[model samples]
Target: MGITDFFSDVWDTFAHPSPDAEAPKGGSSTETPAAGTPEESSEEAEVNKQDAVKSDESQQEQGHIPSDDAEEEEEEEEETVDPKDKLEADCQESKACAPAKHHYDECAERVMGQIENDGKAKEDCVEEFFHLAHCATQCAAKPLFSQLK
Candidate 1:
């Protein structure tokens, strides 16, 4: 038997505590049950067959898919938008952090210009970047977090 079947058999042994389940003479614990017994009954087989037929019938009734647009829409609907994205979008839309953002952009441009001209940047934009982040976070935190669970 498979590992799952063996585990289930072990679980059944412990749950029921049957006396017939004696330790094997020479074989290991991973041994399968004797081959004479059937794994599933005829009734069980018939029920499984019926279920498969019903599933096929349901698919047939649904008919052909029109286009991939429906699938794309479903995927978009299913996706959970991140809260950070909402905060960033709100910050951009509100323009409350515009001054800080402009300063950061100027610092970044200066660094890039230095690198292009001299093959090295005189200063990193960490201070300006942190100022911009602080402004954005302060402006966006209340509205964004209040809506989240």
Candidate 2:
């Protein structure tokens, strides 16, 4: 499931716990059923337990371990998606901070030009840089904060 779905499920579990659930707080439906239902004989229960043990033993003997690819995929997905980068890109693409970005770029270019043409030390564009950063931060803050824990 996606992050949104996961959070939604968590919210739903707390907000609308099933009345028939054994515990005060409801649990996931994915849990295994309780053992020894009415239809199961004692002999059958014993046989089932033995079968389960044998299956486990055979798996261990064969070195057959379950893959955690799903977990790995989830981790990879999170690692690949940098919310800050995404937010910054969004701000740039939307041109919400265009004026500030343009000013910063102009200041940088002017500083570089002076250094190259006049053989002078490069001038700092701290003010312009901060102005651009502040604009981008303003655009990024809401979405970026929402994505983070």
Candidate 3:
């Protein structure tokens, strides 16, 4: 997906969680049917119970039995890494692009300084900023890409 789409998806995921994710807050999965409505047949409830048992057995057979809380905890752990930290770590690992990183950082500093001290608008530097950023990123990826050849 394009960067805009990707970021939009991330924003949506945070802003609007799925119904399944909100179910736990109600304290029970089985909800009582409204008055005058036919209740689920005994056979259907038994089948559902059996299915749940089978699912738990299969999960145990594979290794560990999964629970909603455990799954949520795993998801939380996976998301614990901050994006800025990941970017810094990646830059550190791309040692061959040290000069490019330095140049990119210097350019950023100069541009930001001009905007702050000289009353220049950030719109005036978007193109130059992105060009330097692209150059730096490509330079950083060059060595890694060459290894795949």
What's each prediction's clash count? 0, 0, 0
As a TM-score, model 1 comes out at 0.45
Return the TM-score for each candidate structure. Answer: 0.45, 0.43, 0.30
Candidate 3 per-residue lDDT over residues 1-149, each given as its tens digit:
89999999999999997888755554534566665666877887899999999998988899787779989898878544444444444755466556556666676788778889978845354555565556546654655556446
lDDT of each: 0.79, 0.80, 0.67
Residue pairs in collision within model 1: none
Candidates sorted by lDDT, best first: 2, 1, 3
lDDT leader: 2
Model 2: per-residue lDDT, tens digit, 10-56?
99999985888756676655444455435665777899999999999
Q: Weakest 10 consecutive residues, lDDT, candidate 3?
A: 79-88
Question: Residue 134 deviation, candidate 2, in Å?
Answer: 1.0
Identify the candidate with maximal TM-score: 1
Model 1 stretches with alpha carbons more than 4 Å out: 1-77
Model 2 residue 138 distance off true place after TM-score fit, in angstroms? 1.0
